[model samples]
Target: MNETMRPVLGVSVAIWRGGRVLLVRRGREPFKDHWSLPGGRVEWGESLQDAVRREAAEETGLSLHTPHLVDTLDMIGAGEPPASHFVIVVFTADATGEPVAGDDAAEIGWFEPEAIAALPTTPDLARIVALSQRS
Candidate 1:
């Protein structure tokens, strides 16, 4: 089957500190240039937990662990056969190092929840941040 014909498993981490959340500007599409959590599609043979940690490190250069579940989002395009479908798992984790954009991140910034609401972001990104705060 073609890649876009099936749902892709993906992961993201919400790193919150001092009442702010880390966000990355997406370097690629689906929602390019939009501010989003640091994550990407999971690889074969990798566990979800490992995917979370790997994605965080790859995208932000920050090592994190023991992620708490924050939310899961189904990003599906409306089409005859769906342009794309991604079931993304979200987690909350703590970090020790400053984030530097890499992988699919064009840039990085820390934003308070209120500040996040003003930026152009992926759908439900603001809501996701709110959820992370309660996790």
Candidate 2:
């Protein structure tokens, strides 16, 4: 099997404040330039919560706490043989400090749930936003 076919664990954090969620414009492939949550592939030996915190901080420059697991998404690339497959664990957390783009993020901003529909985003981002709202 090709290494790219192997499923990897990833984490995404929906850092919320004042009825809005933080979103980033991805600066890398697999969703380049698309609006998405702050997250990345989990490193070996890292706990889920730790990965979430690390990713959130790395991508958005904000501190997060008390992450509540919101959903798990199977992010499968669409192509003849598929480009990537990631099992993404999504969480909602309380965030501190203003967000600034860093790492794989091109831009970062807070967005209301209704505003999500106006942006180009990763697959299932709307659903993820809804799930975050319920949590």
Candidate 3:
């Protein structure tokens, strides 16, 4: 397939503790400096659950389990000409231990659903957070 025709696969994890969800500030683009779920691209030969586990550990320093599929996000780039396309698999998982930001995260925090609206985030983050909370 052509480069533009190939859809990149990625995973994002929604980790909840108490009544708040974990979020990481992206240290890279396409949504640099924005608060978003902890995840990254799915490497070749990796299962979706494995990708979610790996990404969550890399970004948030937490071990996650039982990643249940929550949603799928289509991120179509916008520019003079469309630049990229990503099909992100979103998951909700249970986690333990305090989080420390690493990898592609600039910072990390837990926020209530109501508070998420006030922060800048990737598209549909608030909705994803809400959906994950219900799962």
Candidate 4:
């Protein structure tokens, strides 16, 4: 079977610093050029917490800590035709550092809620960020 035929499990972090959150412009597909949270797939034998931290480090070079589960999303019908399905576990963590984009991120920046509202982003991204803040 093609890899896309299977469900993909991934982890994303809402790395918040004060009233702002970190977002990265994707360099790859599924949401290329769209601003989204910093995260990626969870490897085998890794805990959710570790996966969240590692993904943040790889994509944004930030050291995330105390990540707590916020929500899980079934994004099976997201994006354009031939869209890939992702069941992503979202976590919230606090980090402090000057983020430098790497991995699949094309660029990185910190944005307030109002700023994020104006960007092209993954479905439910704003909602996820809101939920992460409240949790």
Candidate 5:
């Protein structure tokens, strides 16, 4: 029997305040060295909401509030090896504590709307942020 491959389903939390968005420098594979939103994979049997909260806490060392589903992205492979196809669900959230990069994040920073254009963000992520700013 041939085994079918499955796309990794993950969630991301886009924490925004005023005109700035929180971004993280990835520490691992799949986009290492690029600026991206903070989040992680959903565990088996875990609710989406719970997964978002858990990933936020684990990666950023902060507690988020009132997250709302914002957008969904289908990421196709762009680079080499183990080429991933991901279905990423994005959530907008509010958090209190200052962000400190942990786990898979190498660094954390907040980017203003204008600065967002200059960041090395993924194409899908750029679209999400654009729509979010308008909404």
Candidate 6:
């Protein structure tokens, strides 16, 4: 079977501090109003590092530095209305500035470890967060 579908590549920044991770409420389609990590599609001709920095800055008004690539995830929705699958590259980063909500995010907030379970997150996102916390 020949399939013409190509998975979209997404880059997300997992900014952690004081046992909490930054979460953003998306205000657009394909998970609209859902709280998730900060990120978006990677553009052509841009390096992965550059994509990370650009996505981070565009979504959250913060400059990321020393963003080490951590993990790659293949995400697929499980409900009756399945969502498009995406290949997400997550990076653990250290930044020197405060975060302000921007871009597709309607609002942004920090969530403690205990609060993560209550937030609406994809399975891949939950797995990545767990793996990142262990490292």
Clashes found in each candidate (C-alpha, N, C closer than 3 A): 0, 0, 0, 0, 0, 0
lDDT string, candidate 3, 11-122, tens digits? 9999998888999999999899999999999999999999999999999999997999999999888864568788999999999878999999999998989998899999
Model 2 TM-score, 2 decimals = 0.94
RMSD of candidate 4 to the true fold?
A: 2.6
Best by lDDT: 3
What is the Cα-based lDDT of residue 135 in candidate 3? Answer: 39
lDDT of each: 0.90, 0.91, 0.92, 0.88, 0.82, 0.81
- Using TM-score as the yardstick, the better of models 1 and 5 is 1
Q: Each candidate's root-mean-square deviation in Å?
A: 2.0, 1.6, 1.6, 2.6, 2.4, 2.4
Give the per-residue lDDT of model 5 (tens digit) for 34-90.
Answer: 888898888999888999899988888889897889889888786554367788889
Residue 50 CA error for candidate 4 (Å)?
A: 1.1
Clashing pairs in 1: none
- TM per candidate comes to 0.93, 0.94, 0.94, 0.89, 0.89, 0.87
Per-residue lDDT of model 6, residues 7-61, tens digit only: 7898988888887888888889778887888998989988788998998899889
Candidates arranged by lDDT, highest first: 3, 2, 1, 4, 5, 6
Clashing pairs in 5: none
Error of 1 at 116 (Å): 1.6
Q: Please report how far candidate 3 places residue 126 from its true position, in Å.
A: 0.7
Q: Which stretches of candidate 4 lie over 4 Å from their true place?
A: 1-4, 78-82
1-135, model 4: which lDDT tens digit per residue?
354487788999988776898899999987899999998998999998999999999999888869889999977764545367889999988886779999999999989977888899988999999998843
Estimate, for each residue in 41-77, the C-alpha lDDT of model 2 and write its tens digit.
9999999999999999999888997999999999888
What root-mean-square deviation over C-alphas does model 3 reach?
1.6
For model 1, the superposed segments whose C-alpha errors exceed 4 Å read: 1-4
